[model samples]
Target chain A: MIKRTISSIALALGLAVATIPALASEGEGLAPAGTNIRDQASLQRGAKLFFNYCVGCHSLKYVRYSRLASDLGLSEEEVMTNLNFTGAKFGEPVISHMPADDAKTWFGKDPPDLSLEARAKGVDFIFNYLNSFYLDPTRPVGWNNTVFPNASMPNPLWELQGLQTAVHGEAAPGQEAVVEKLQISTPGRMSPEEFRGATRDLTAFLEYAAEPAALERQSIGVWVILFLAGLTFLLYLLKHEYWKDVHESH
Target chain B: MANVFSRIGDWVNERAPNLAPTYRKHMTEYFAPKNFNLWYYFGSLALLVLVNQIVTGIFLTMNYKTSALEAFNSVEYIMRDVEWGWLIRYMHSTGASLFFVVVFLHMFRGIMYGSFKRPRELVWILGMLIFLVLMAEAFMGYVLPWGNMSFWGAKVIISLFGTIPYIGGSLVEWIMGDFLPADATLNRFFALHVIALPLVLLLLVVLHLAALHEVGSNNPDGVDVKHGPKGNKWNPEKPIDAIPFHPYYTVKDLVGVGFFLTIAAFIIFFAPTFGGWFLEHDNFTPANNLVTPSHIKPSWYFTPFYAILRMIPSFFGTAIWGVIGMFGAILLLALLPWIDKGEVRSVRYRGLGFRIALGVLVFSFLALGLVGAGVTAEVIPEWFPGADVTTWENAFGRLMVLGYFGFFVFVWVYTRFGFEKTKPVPERVTMHD
Candidate 1:
């Protein structure tokens, strides 16, 4: 009886383990479908959004002002005068305006660096999340997110994008449903389409900021692969020529 | 004119086959039975987890400062200031634990199926190397936040290497490149943990998979397939044996990858730092060498070994023994094929001795792990009269340590003399038809 119990338990455990791989294959979230985010113009707009909105709270500490200026085709003087804070030089990093302790105390969370934000949370997630914010007065920030719940940070771009609320209602029997459509309660500077475009640019900029080398690396990779392929072809031809004489002689 | 056009078409077809073989040929060529079911997925999952770690880690490193003063603050900066920085940090931190879980499963699979057997020795050895490198990576990564546990945990683990006879002190110094696990050690380890070791791991993983594909896979049955279908009772049809790697394995892997990500995401977004084991409260405190943390422990993965190490009495020699036992556990696995001499590969046909030995081995490990976590009972008080330790507790601890070592010896003996010789093979076979 003990042996049978043990065998049964083992079999059950084995079946569970076997099912893991099958169950694992579902719902890849928020990575854009079939889109390569390599357009230079898109990256440029993304940089502009990052500087205007994101730099106030989040710092790209690893990225120097000079590097950003050169990469994004901005003048060092423009970067220093417009974007630079914390009395940092042109070669210095984009440090946050808020002190760590104070930020933590005020927001109940410290603001993180934006440098690698894009690489960490893919561009689509950022894009969708920025647009997903809806009003919730109960939360610490007076704002809630569909993508991220109970977010401590308020919608910083609310002035430009305007206040939008989600309408909640019940679904039919045996269904789980909560539908949300943005209804502007208060108007801001930009229209909805324009606001979305701005957010897209911001997300793109953050993505570029996260891995500034990605664009260069990808382009370089293409050339390198091409060169290697050509070399392989040459080697193959050489092998054929060399082997032909041996086969004929034999 | 029609014949010339047809000839041209035929020429294109002949060359096209070379460029891209028919689905059937391609399937036969590459999709040949990995025969690998559960165990095979973990390595690939480990790779996916590694990539996740790297991506998340790079972002965290961007904002993270290694300086003693700013290290803790910078990490906080990432959580708050950077847009979605919190998400990235959680993903990377959670990924470190997940990496170990997958690798452990992968290594255990290697053991259970005798994937480490003879010709595939290099695969197992490389895996051990990867495991060691992973440990180092996790250790270095823990120290990056410069939290309370990070500082003291490094101190304790580093202190372990200081147990050798004459050159012990020097060896520790050499390993750290300093007197202690200080700023220089953190910096170099950060470099190694992020860049150097990952590259090596990637290369080793590729080699590990290549070796696996070459040998096909050892199933739970463990039958050698070289002797044709007559020797083995089960035979997978040629078409089933040959599935295209691109669509079939790729889709399968993607599904597995998706599921792994979902679990990881749920943990990262929902419940990062599930209390004591995942994220210790003390780790939130900044690193302070002046003040030693109370009851410093390594991450959950290392707890079992750490528990074993602490069970030893001497503060000095105990550390050395811990290191030996940890490495010995892995090194012993490399020699398992030679150690177990049963002619039949499957555990199904194995004798009572093997089963009992396996059970005991598992139990001993679990007991050692429990003791390592410092779960001691106060049953008897006479073991150390002067000291604050109880007799039963002390004896239990010592017994578990012995049991841990005894498992290897038990398996070695059982495989040598306890098993019977195989009987003659059955000739007749019945098919489903």
Candidate 2:
């Protein structure tokens, strides 16, 4: 009886363990593997979007103007004249004009730095979030986010992306009321396709900025592994040559 | 035409087989138990989760700033401005907690099956090392946000190190590279958390797996199969005993991983701040050194040990005792194989004394954890202020602490001499064929 019970417990535990993978498969959100962040064109476009739109509230303090100019194939003068804000030098980082205290008072949360933003969040999330803005009157910013609810900051990209109101239907028996879809009441500066393209460029840029070395590293990694594999093959041949006579005798 | 293709395929096959004969030999000869149940999947799943964490973490570090003024905002910037930054951040944070959950279950499985016995001692030791590295990783990762909890949590944990006799304060400073856990510590920790420690963990994991593979896995029945027939080792061969890891185990793990993600996603996407615990309400606020959080607690994983530390009476000595006890529990696990001396492999054959002793240890741990979580204070009468200082909430705290350590001592003693010998299993009694 004891033996039966112990074995049964072990069996039960094993079965319980098997259930984990099934759970993982559900709600596997749409994040495809591999990101095309290394393309210079993508990076250039991303940088442009970042400078024009994101830099107003966000900062990239670790990234120097000099580095950006050289890496992106821009002249120092071009970077200084175009990207550099008031009172900034060629060597300085792109610091936000907004004070931290002022930002907190305005947004109820300080606007975060954009230096590592792409690296910290993936390109897909940024793309989705940028397009997820909806109108909410209760919020301090006169807007809420589907991606991040109760967000303190107003949809800064509202003019370009346009206005959207959430359409909610009645709740099911146990379920809460759901957002059926977002209805665009008014159009913004850019068309839907144009807005998407802009966000995609921004996402691509942040992705590049987050890991500027990723593209180079991945390409370099492939060659390194291949070289090592080739070396191993040569070594194997040498071993065979040395052991040829001994193996025949055996 | 068909004959020509077949001939070519056969020629390729014969030459290929001879060139890598050892590969084929291993494919056929390598024998894992056919009856390996769901419990066996965790180790591999853990590896998968670890890789996910490292990959996601590396990307996050690319954009993450270590400065006090910018750290919090940098994280927000990642969420708002950086493309797909939210996904990477969520995956990493969720993965960290999941890593612990899986490891805890894996360790519990080890305890259930007596996998930490004799010959497998090194594997257990390596596991303990991995656990230590994981704790360090989690602690460091928590500080990256530089929120109120991040600042105070670091302060509380680092101060514990200051309780050591002579040079403790200096040691803490040396670790931090400053007077307090400041920008220097955050920058260094970012490097270590993202790079150095993960490399160590990877090496240890390889060693741990290599050791387990060498000894083969232990089953619920703790018996050694070293002397059994070469083909009929461990247990009798059964159809369920052997299944391909790729599809069979992969599918199982996928299911488990899916379930875990659903729960984690719900928390991350919807109820990120469940009560005040998951993402502490105050942590939403930026770091402020002047103010102390009302009830500062480490993430849930460390709460049990943190509670144990609080139970101690002396300010300085309390911290010392806490560190010692935490390390001691882990160190003792490495020694379990040597301590247990039962003749039978299965718990079924083990004596009642051994079973009861094991039960007591489990109960005591749970009790200590409960007391650590503020239960003991509420239950114990307030009149005994002396008890609060002397014991954790007076007499109750003292008794529970004693019970915690006492259980370990008792298990070592009980396993050493308490079990009785038993006859070999009868042919009819053997379940495996």
Candidate 3:
């Protein structure tokens, strides 16, 4: 009875655990963010973009600019020259000098620290939200978002994304101004595809920023699981040897 | 090396009198049926995780901030500033989920084998108490983080006490020790999480073991090994086909431990957040008093009960039925030994009604857990027909809440009334299929 139940349960447990990876939080018209946190080059591009644009308002206070340098395969000199817009020290956190009160006055609210934003709002949400921005003349920021409606922050990458006009259709009969999609009217230096790649890279960087050790830990976890597998093999042999006496004697 | 260990043992025995005897009784000579199998592993695996949680928890407490102001930052500080603190934090956080997973499995093993029957009733009761304390400990530990979920989850859960009509408001205020969930609640929860609950857990674990040891084990066959006659002179004290736990089960459990650690390490290192099941996405943000997140889902472990809590319609004076249903759900599990009246202990020999009931119960529990975690049931669409998604979802949830309680009620009814032929249990532990 014990043997049958155990074998059955172990089999079921294996199948149940196998299903977890498939449980991606897919919903609505949200695009899949295939973020590759281990891709250092993509992460580097993301870091560059984040520091250049987002840092003017938002901050990554948990992350050291110097640590970012090493993790993204850049030297202190290169980081100092390129990404250090606000003149932060190499060892200091990636915080901008823009004061909160002043920023609040400008944007109607202080832009939250993006240190844990990727984790808090999720990578897909961030990836989608950035791309969901559209032109809305009546709004204070002159922009609205499909992902986050009435967001206070303007489309900071509007120059690259150009002007996106919101195409609307009724979800039901009475609903007005329900956006169906976005279309770029006047394109900027970067095309839509290039902007998507940039956002993906930014998403990847935020994924890394949320937990910088994720890439390293994922790499090390393979070895750790493998080592445990080795120990499991040895113990299996030991168990079979011990159980031999009981089986033969019986 | 062997002689030196014996000498040290003898030296210790001289001072500590009967140390060897105690060790023999608890470890070396403790005998169990040779037919014990995989599910037996989780008992020891649970112990392994408890040790991991306690050790990791102690280290975390050394650095953890008790006040709401620094709690979120303190976690970040530990993650970044302290050496290997990220690993420790992941281990503890990840271990909390793993602990429940293993405990749930262990309890399932009990249900599968009827380990809660007859002479083992006290063991079941003690195990139930341990589970209760464990839930409290996990809740308090979660609050220590002071994240969005931490603060709000505490507020929402503690506010359940306020459902008591006359005394409810004061009780919640007393529990929080302030107008809302603030530093005082955080500090008190910290004390209980670190100091009080762990002591209860330790005591209950000891008692659980003692009760089980006294009763020997209920094997998969649901037969007591100590029945009939003792074994031959070569193995005089133990019953037929029984083996010592130390060399046999200990080694067997070690392989299980290896597998468990493999799974745990994978999560802790690769997906500690487990895509927001083990660690919720909302927990990444510091607690904000003014704004609540769009949705407040409990951790995956609590989802089933959380579902039960939500199943009750507000028309039943809002909170009263939900609170009653939530507590009663757990209380049913605790009272199962007396409630279940099946002639046979193991499900292997249980009646047809029992088999079907068990299947539904497991399904309902898992379905409820998923639904609780904001996963909609696919079956609901087919059954409900015309209603909007959320309405159907709530209706399905209500149906599940009914099935969940109906399972316990069925156990009580089936055990008392159902008739089924019992399988002829063997006298000795036999390996042959």
Weakest lDDT window of 10 consecutive positions for candidate 1 chain B: B424-433
Off by over 4 Å in 2: A1-250, B1-29, B225-255, B258-267, B270-277, B315-319, B370-398, B419-433
CA lDDT scores, all candidates in order: 0.66, 0.66, 0.84
Ranking by TM-score: 3, 2, 1
Query: What docking grade does candidate 3 earn?
Result: medium
Candidate 3 on A1-250: residue-level lDDT in tens?
5466667677656645653543346334578888898788999999889987899888899999888888889999999999988877889998878898998888789889998988888788899998989889879878888898999988989887788889888677666658888999989779889999999999999988988777678778889999999999899899888877677656
Identify the runs in model 1 with alpha carbons over 4 angstroms from their true place.
A1-250, B1-28, B31-40, B230-246, B314-319, B375-393, B418-433
Best by DockQ: 3
Name the candidate that leads on lDDT. 3
| Model 1 lDDT tens row, B335-396 | 67777666655444566666666666656665555455443432123334555554555577
- Taking every candidate in turn, the Cα RMSD to the unseen true structure, in Å, is 15.9, 14.1, 2.4
- Among all candidates shown, the one with the greatest TM-score: 3
Predicted candidate 2 versus true structure: per-residue lDDT over B273-320, tens digit per residue? 333334454465567888776557787566657766766566542457
Work out the TM-score per prediction.
0.57, 0.58, 0.95
lDDT (Cα, tens digit) per residue for candidate 2, span A6-75: 5855664454344333222211252432345656666677677788777888988666787678667889
The regions of model 3 sitting more than 4 angstroms off are A1-23, A170-174, B1-4, B232-234, B314-318, B377-386, B418-421
RMSD (CA, angstroms), candidate 1: 15.9
